[model samples]
Target chain A: MMDPLLHVKNLKKYFPLRKGFLEKEKTYVRAVDDVSFSIRRGNSFGLVGESGSGKTTVARAILRLIEPTEGEVRFEGMDICRSSESEINEMRREMQIIFQDPHSSLNPRKTVFKIVSEPLIIHEGLRGKKLRRRVEELLETVGLKSEHMFRYPHELSGGQKQRVGIARALSLNPKLLILDEPTSALDVSVQAQMLNFLESLQRELDLTYLFISHNLAVIRYTCDTVGVMYLGKIIEMGEAEKVFSMPRHPYTKALVSAVPIPQAEQPETAILLEGDIPSATHIPSGCRFHTRCFEKIGAVCEEREPETYCFPDGSQVNCHLFKSTALDDEAGHGGGSGKPLETKDR
Target chain B: MKPVLEITDLKIEFDTFEGTSHVLDGIHLSLGKKDTLGLVGETGCGKSITAKAILRLLPVPPARLVSGEILFGGEDLLKKSDEEMKEIRGRQIAMVFQDPMTFLNPVFSIEEQLVDVISAHSNRNGSRKEIDRKEAKKKAVALLGEVKIPQPDVRIKSYPHEFSGGMRQRVLIAMALSRSPQVLIADEPTTALDVTIQAQILKLLHELVERHGNSVLLISHDLGVVAKVCRRIAVMYAGSIVENCSTEALFNEPFHPYTQGLLNSILTFSKRKDAAQGIQGGIPDLIHPPSGCRFHPRCSRAMKICEIEKPSPVEAEKNHVVSCHLYPVRKVKSF
Candidate 1:
């Protein structure tokens, strides 16, 4: 009911494969092609995909880190893609990103104090005493000691470095945070700690999260809404519980089944997908997932692209199998058999 | 079941600039013939070091094998001569490294690399008849085909750079299996691959190990992956194997606190009611690790004696051993 904190509509980012200077024909890697999702004020929306599925590109495009090729990204009704540099800079105070790799993201030369206070200094222009106090407070908030403020990035462990990264992201008190594989670089125990910490932080700060990760279990644990991306397209988007429990799309089913569950004497029913994901530059025709889709129904899946079908449970799936049921009812916001109200069909 | 490879009290120390890092402190592991045993641990837990020590791959000057015996085929591998070990390296115990790209030579074609592995393995010892290039190439193609690489004849000619990450891993597997080693040590073989690719690789590895009838020591950080393929699981904490048990027993009821914590930490697909839980602290610095039990510092059920004395391995159940003070020693064993 409260307008979604961050709304991305039909976002696209294409990286061109440059050949010669004189070459007229250009080929593009469709990284984030026609992705649309909305995150509520305090809810976490997870974008789950594999290596080249373009989940990171979506996050980058939303932040205008890499300019989107087309479509609207409305952050609290403000057009982010079309905003001026100064306007975007002002908007950045409310939105922040926690990068995937803590080892490379932080400046090696900068101490924990400098890294955490950079945003505060740049935005609010807080002076020496005020800045030191704020940095110490931020470090303490992320479970680091005041003594850790003087330590360099190299001196910190992987888990400690990640804590500092979190501390830095929380420094600005941003309303929306885009976490791109925040715990993938960490060990399992450390990853759990980070996940719980992020959850607690969200509840305490009422922060909107765009959580991007390839780890399905992490997504299922942390996110309220989930989007399953294949190649570049989001084939499935729904409540995390619904999508994970009863995955509609064939790719979603395979992706879910592929994850090795740590259970005792479980059935070896994991759908081992044949071959690797097709290159984004040469994305498959029609349904991008058709090459490896197990439940693919012949010609239609190969010739024509599928439309987003909204179900009664407010879940949306883009697949030919759900076509018959989708056409029976009218289009609506949440409960409908037809196309979803948020995303376009074309 | 007799062990194909048995390591008892294997202690290894690395002489670094800072100090002597006790990387593998009295590690005990046994891989039975035609069995899959997974060594699961965190980054600095010395899983790789243990694997390297089994093959005697660690540099001598910096790496001092403090005390232990690596028994392979009823002989101590540590006492074996350098030339003798070289012969056994690939022919007896082959290893599949984590990154395929780094392990594979960029300049050579897949055919050349496969041929090199095949010929080098066959032409060792000098007493046997030399294997020709033509015979090696033919065998290489068959090996590739065995790993399910489509149209192996043509693809074998393609360079490593041309192949995808998963395909490169398959090539690595093929190379490791070329010699038909008695033992296969895959150190995080599928860690570099995507989830789907990882699944495929895991399945392929399971099938290959079954077909070849070779023991496998799989080193990985993912419990899910180990649970999927391995029959037995070993949980290592800070250079020491804290728990060793059957996969079913581990999943059903883990004895060691570290093993329980590790299992609880893994985020499973099935929705959990409680919030994600983690161990209290990170893995300790191995250079000056915690005395007695390295995990005692971060352990939830740590007692006063855990700080001073190292608890010996106890047989909690049949084929289930745990090194923790909480579980009193019922039956003491060498490992």
Candidate 2:
């Protein structure tokens, strides 16, 4: 197998929660705590989680839009997290992000040409007719005509605006693109077009993508590898098809069941998790998902968090059920708990 | 089965500075009692406009219902006077918008908002002596409880901003259901929410409508959301019902090219990870729409007939209807 294009090891980002008269530091909101994964060259890695699940934070951390507090991020064997100021600036040319909200991402004052050409001006030092031609070429590549160059962001529809955003990201000729919920804000019909464009662009440009979305359907369709996160931890990661088809973690199963199958006559009885997601500042003891988990084991689950266990097929799951079986054999208990363990957290 | 709300040949136009935007043209939908009808369309496809037209809630100067009748309980809602419509608005037909913050008053407490909505259509007359504010407050709390808001007693006293985005939406839903309207119009109800919250809210709406024996007209841009809640669906394009069929039929065998493109676009995580395809090109300008079929410019299977002629709705089966030239053989025989 070829070497992975990007490797992330124990990536952690914690936002400070400040309060009081002096605005003293309180607790930290563990946004993207200890997430680790890699994306192969020309392949897409999808990060799936509900809102506040740190999927966006993970994407932002990869782009270095915000710095990571701990861990390593290697792009093509070079540690981007450890790079100097000048080195990081040059490295940005190879990594770019497409924001979820197209309207807010683009500068309202700038024309389409200026928005698309800005990256080239700063990074490549191209100017005059040469740059203008490149801008038009990029726009055309994304399906926009030359006439759209003069128009501002407000003139375009949601789908067109998104295409312009895509055009801007492609302007830099980045090796990897971080798409943060790119199509969640788009209409279903327009979303399809964007997805197809992304796929084709990947083939033509040999681009790698780190796609972040809460939509399971979108993630399933676009990603080669899928990571399911909850409370800043990746509970499951594996081949997109295998993980989705046979989700090892109960949370992954619940999330997959949540998505409405387009035409299936009998909708599956969703593994509905009762109660709202707990506050990140005050995370539950032991497993982060134990409060909502249906197959939680007894005191062991509440006392000790589960670690990732790799399967023969390269699938990895961070769940007590998978861990407890291993522990039972080690302890010579002969795999007989007899019944499903009821956790104290529940 | 007679439909509780029937909109026939509905046409709406917005007079903007640019030109007259033919927003909704020849829209026809029928919502039967206790049945859920999904109004699926892209942004600016007039799904919201159609919903506003039903309650006569379209902003006056810019929006005008050019022609057609919106019949509710055998009466034309389009012809209803402002006073008559006010009586029917919350009592017979209530609507929950996408953003609860925009619809909810920031300064007002949840209790005040819920009570105001209940009293607006309540039969209790202007006798202050007979009307109990405490009773109304209790009813408000109960309504909140029905929507599954925890600690409804305490939460009702808090302002809209105090609640999370999902909780505020629940509060809005509670207010809409306070009067126990026969029909509820949810326009992108879960668009702004997270997936888990969206799932919870969708489930709640489905349960509430069933328990109350009320019908729902769910308008959403996401087909996934619609498939989860609605039994039947109406696919709208360029302000007209392009296809109407059961959710099962629409997903399994979509007759219209637009519907097929929409289904193919949705990325199902359990399926293959090939990038979902999107319909090429943007929706045409409503003011200067295409001469015949609005989707002709982007459609891959466009025919010569689609260029110059509009297709009328042809009944494909007992209740299924589609408006497209491609279904010519079925149209000629059915029509």
Candidate 3:
């Protein structure tokens, strides 16, 4: 499929907890454990999960903003994890990240002009008037006026500040933009404007987006492919429409049902999970979602993790309930161009 | 339906150094008994201020209540003395704040926090001798259990830091409902929580409010959240309620231009043809809002009269009311 823009294979990021005095055993919080996904060119891939589900960690690991413990992050056929420092720095020009909070992401001290111009100056070595013109162009591209360039971060409103952040992210002319909860901080009306602007920008620039948000409705609106993360593991992945409409995995079902729609009439029943997400440090055995899974079946779920089961419509779910589907697909294809039976980990 | 809590001609101005900010401009709201009414608005729309004004919680010099009557249970809450308000605050009109972590004391155990609320109520009522520590502790556990916090007995001893955000919110709910208040004001209660957790909290709130038969004033920026828990919604813009109607009517046939814009701006899961265009321009500066109608500058359907004269509330339907020139009150025709 035109060599996916970004291919992340088994990306794992673990942060080690401080060791106690006279302790021999070392423990680590597996924030992003064995997460693998590929984003096709010009497509938006949404990563959705509750807090501490490692969605942000996966984004950081791919960009090498935070180093991955193990995995191959192939961006345009270049291994980011294995690339040298200089090579990675050069690659940074192609991939940019838009942080969640514009309030904290933008430096309060710097004017909008400086914030937008810094990347251009650092990368292209443009000078004086040229840089000013470029910064103004970027600001205008993000729907802000040239007049806004002189204003500090605090001087601008929430929507304006976010536009500046977007303008900064676009300054490098990056092919891929990892937007982490871009609209969560915005007001509803402003969020709508931003979403529409982003969609138009994507079409105009031919950019690939790795959009991470906890808001299902926003994700559904912005993304093409959706991945549901639970305690550092992607339990389900498929087309956004399919995944949201007919969610297979129990976690996905619960999550889809959990989203409160704007309509007055609610669904008859929602599968309410019992407790909060388990700690990343102490992930539950077998299926990571077993602790709170509503549709869990017997000992298999508690004993062993399910293999990735592929459907005819290109959706993949990791749950034992779909075990027979994978077997049938393998049987029909005779192990030739079949979708499901790739288990290198086993 | 007789309104248990009524706010009429409410006008509040914040006298800041940067000129007088007319925060709340002639707001009118009514909460009937056992009503679950939502106050939905964008940030700086004075939703919180209105709630604060009801409790006389706004600091006076900076925030001057220019004119208003907050009638709670046939009495003017605005005119109530501090002591009288204190008696009514927790026992009658309870509040659940947005951020539970900050509202809850970190050092105290959940049990201690819950017991303190109970004891405070008793001490204020001049019945301090009736309820002891043991009785309060038992009631605290029961309250925690009622909010669906797992293992209330054991969890009650744990500190605020030990509980998750959802659990902490549950504790706050328990504290708010401890004395069984007549009215509960939840100001963006689930805004800080995750979607799943928010669902749980909303469901709990819906169930509890239904069970207790307490009138609730749910203030939130999210229409979806308001839709889930509230039967009636009051859409606030700038410093005024532009529209107030039944949840169904507001969603299906919104009368006000700003209300229509706000609804159109939200991205719903259900597929639709047109993209949300959103409202143009930011919220108006309250200090020098607009010439007349506060929303006129941004309203697409703004008429010339909208700039010259402030529109008064017009009954669009039996219960639905909107403050807009589009739906001007029709003159009664003589037979």
List-wise, what DockQ does each model earn? 0.76, 0.58, 0.69
lDDT of 1 at B292: 85
What tens digits encode model 2's per-residue C-alpha lDDT throughout B102-134? 999999998998888776556543443443577
Q: After superposition, how far is residue A155 of candidate 2 from its true place, in Å?
A: 3.8
lDDT of candidate 3 over A1-346, digit per residue (tens): 2678888888899999878878888789999988878888899999999999999999988889899999889999999999999999999999999999999999999999889999898899999999998988898899999889899999888899999999999998999999999998999989988998999999999999999999888898999888899889888888899899899999889988888777778676977878998889988888888888878888899989776777656677888887876568765522222232221111
Candidate 3 chain A vs. true chain A: TM-score? Answer: 0.95
lDDT measured at residue B183 in model 2 versus the true structure, 0 to 100: 95
**lDDT by residue (tens digit), candidate 1, A120-144:** 9899999889999999899988999
How closely does chain A match the true chain A in each prediction, as TM-score? Answer: 0.95, 0.92, 0.95
* lDDT score of residue B221 within candidate 2: 84
What is the Å distance of residue B112 in model 3 from its true position?
0.8
Candidate 1: regions farther than 4 A off: A329-346, B125-127, B331-335
Q: Report how far off residue A4 is in candidate 1 (Å).
A: 1.1
DockQ of 2: 0.58
Clashes of each: 0, 4, 0
Task: Give the DockQ (C-alpha) for candidate 3.
Answer: 0.69
Candidate 1 docking category? Answer: medium
Q: Residue A190, candidate 2: how far off, in angstroms?
A: 2.7
